[model samples]
Target: MKTTKILLAGMTALLLASCGTHKTLMEQKPAPGDTPRPAADSTSHKLSYVQHISDKALYQKNVVSNLTFTVNNGRKDITVPGILRMRKDEVVRLQLLIPILRSEIGRIEFTKDYVLFIDRIHKQYVKAGYNDVAFLRDNGISFYTLQALFWNQLFIPRQQRVSEADMSQFSVDTHRLEVDGSAKIVLRDGKMTYKWVIPALWDQIAHTAVSYTSPTHGTSELSWFYEDFRPFGSKQFPASQSVEIHTPAIGQRPAKTLKASFELDGFSDAGDWEPFTTPSDKYKKVSVEEILGKLMNF
Candidate 1:
């Protein structure tokens, strides 16, 4: 189990996969005893209770660091140190490091046109567009969905793109749920539901859940949960976050899942991000099939 966990976590090559510090924002806590926080953003103010959620411009660009990264699926549990820097419509770059030696074990860079994953220790990498990867070519995975998830904004599947107007039209059979004193906004549309709630004094989205179903591929679920809200420049960002993805069994194949959790020890836009450098001729380049097969064998 441990060995399999290592390989699965390390090969998470596709593990499909926020902050703070304003005095006015920190004035109140999302929950009692928590620090104070700035009032809601201008965008959040425009929408009603249910409308505030689907705010696409939820945040501007920012970098985050000092994190403990982990990936688990009951069978494997692996954790490491990591860092991330992302800007909406620009890029999302991440690196996982070895603790004691502070050596970088892996890194993945995402851009509008492409996604790159590199195994620094082994010098293997995957560089391709979502369409280039046959497995995810049909899945509701895209630069926009990722951008929304990391930016802490609401997202809907297969809607041309992420925008405030598009979301406004997403009103289907909608409803709400009050859990633990917080109202969870649930919007059910066609074979999916988008649900979330404001955590405390902070105004932005703290959590998002997305479930999707297809007759041919079975059911898949993805969620992002936040914690450890801390002050950034003028806003508070969740310092700790957990992202989960699950795909149920289809046909004869078994189900698969990946859970990744991370905490931010550092948050700043101090580093540079670039596309993964093309490997030298000495390295062999393989197709997505080759990469997936190798990962399974690992």
Candidate 2:
């Protein structure tokens, strides 16, 4: 009887362990680091520390890199060789190519004035202002927001850049550091919330998430993860990055999530490529929705 009781106890422990592992795997929240620490003593001091970190991590200049770009839309996954070009505060362009031949297949560019997309495979293109794009219009996201995410910096909406004076708007939470030695800095504007997580022993941003909630439009969140840092100038740049966007179900559309991952081969400050591309007359001009649907389906 004692041996039977022992066997039952062992099975109960195994069941509990399995349940715990499943919970950890399914949790959407960022994991806390193993290290622990207390919150900062003063608010002003914390703000100053974040500002200093931001200033030191800034990378300004034209950058070019060859990257592996992968996009997953829950149902399907596709990856292709690509090139990333950024002309500081001017434009960000991504060109995806056919794997072996290295021929261009698609291009997406973001500039201060407009967003441009070229579907070389279909000979279609989309050139429109942010307000004209449904996703951008609904989320209140602008070119500057995209710029900040790519550059790994903080930003304020509707503004071209976040200035020193704007640093006061952000709040820092150090309590999590006690659990894992990482810190979370947050800024809230109306219904939009922006959060950046800095890992322990690192000055650069390890992750960033922007979330928007609205009664009429439902809710959405964009999370960006940075890893594989490499030296650029005097600062470290993320050589690998991934972005995931989650949108709540709206009517019959149902819920949807889109994820994109980029692994850069190398970094450069070269500015050889043209910053803008004007679609040729042979390409048909399509609605943003049509072009996006085709790209997503690809």
Candidate 3:
């Protein structure tokens, strides 16, 4: 009986050890400060600092915003301000306030399938299919123009790989952290040729600055300022942001300066952001020249 009891006690201890080991493994969470995936990986895009920044320090509560932007088309200078009202599931109402011909231009809307532009002054509208918005062929990738659309498919974590700094030409530092189940990335890079600062604070770009040498542009540089961070529902970012891109206009003695600011001053529940839809009856078949004149308001 004594020998049998010893074997039973040993078996019971072994079983308990196995159970404890399983429980520990189940409780394990992803470690903080893990690096974002590489840039070449299609499933791991979006460089962030979620591994470095502390979430408890950056949770913004109850904030909405308006964005004001300035654009210099070389021939004319303009300021455009946009407002975003947030809703559940990251849906939002984006309103663009444009200043044109010394007047406040009407709002433009963007939906999943189309781009809508409305001329409040002329009571006319311009509609472009998502496919027609491309200036070139359907390459499936756009560097800048697509910046207008901040889609989760385009900017979300793990959607694409993050680019690495060429340490031979530049130095880099990155930090990441997790907060509220989201990732954040902060990066800084510099070299003898140029310098840039990207603060992926709380997975949102807090600020960015870039400078480089150009033979024609003559050492062009741009700086982006982000502030007034507010949270709309679950989304959080700057309520107002500004960008300045400067270059030397050929005839202008000093470099011409282009400054743009976007502010999300106010937002409301606009339901779904349907791209502006233009009615077919509003457009009449006309000659190319006539269409050009109409577009130019001639």
Top candidate by TM-score: 2
* Ten contiguous residues with the weakest lDDT in model 1: 18-27
Candidate 3 residue spans exceeding 4 A from truth:
1-82, 85-104, 109-116, 123-171, 174-204, 210-222, 250-255, 266-270, 279-298
| Cα misplacement distance, residue 210 of candidate 3 (Å) | 5.8
Query: Per-candidate TM vs. native?
Result: 0.76, 0.83, 0.42
lDDT of 1 at 220: 70
- Full-model lDDT, candidate 3: 0.35
For candidate 2, lDDT tens digit of each residue in 31-113? 33332322478777777766865775546578899988776646555677889999878898888777789988777788988
lDDT of 2: 0.69
- Report the number of the highest-lDDT candidate: 2
Rank candidates, TM-score, best first. 2, 1, 3
TM-score between candidate 1 and the true structure:
0.76
Residues 128-232, candidate 1: write the lDDT tens digits.
787876545555456766766666666665443455455444432222222223345455666666666554445556667777777777657777777776766
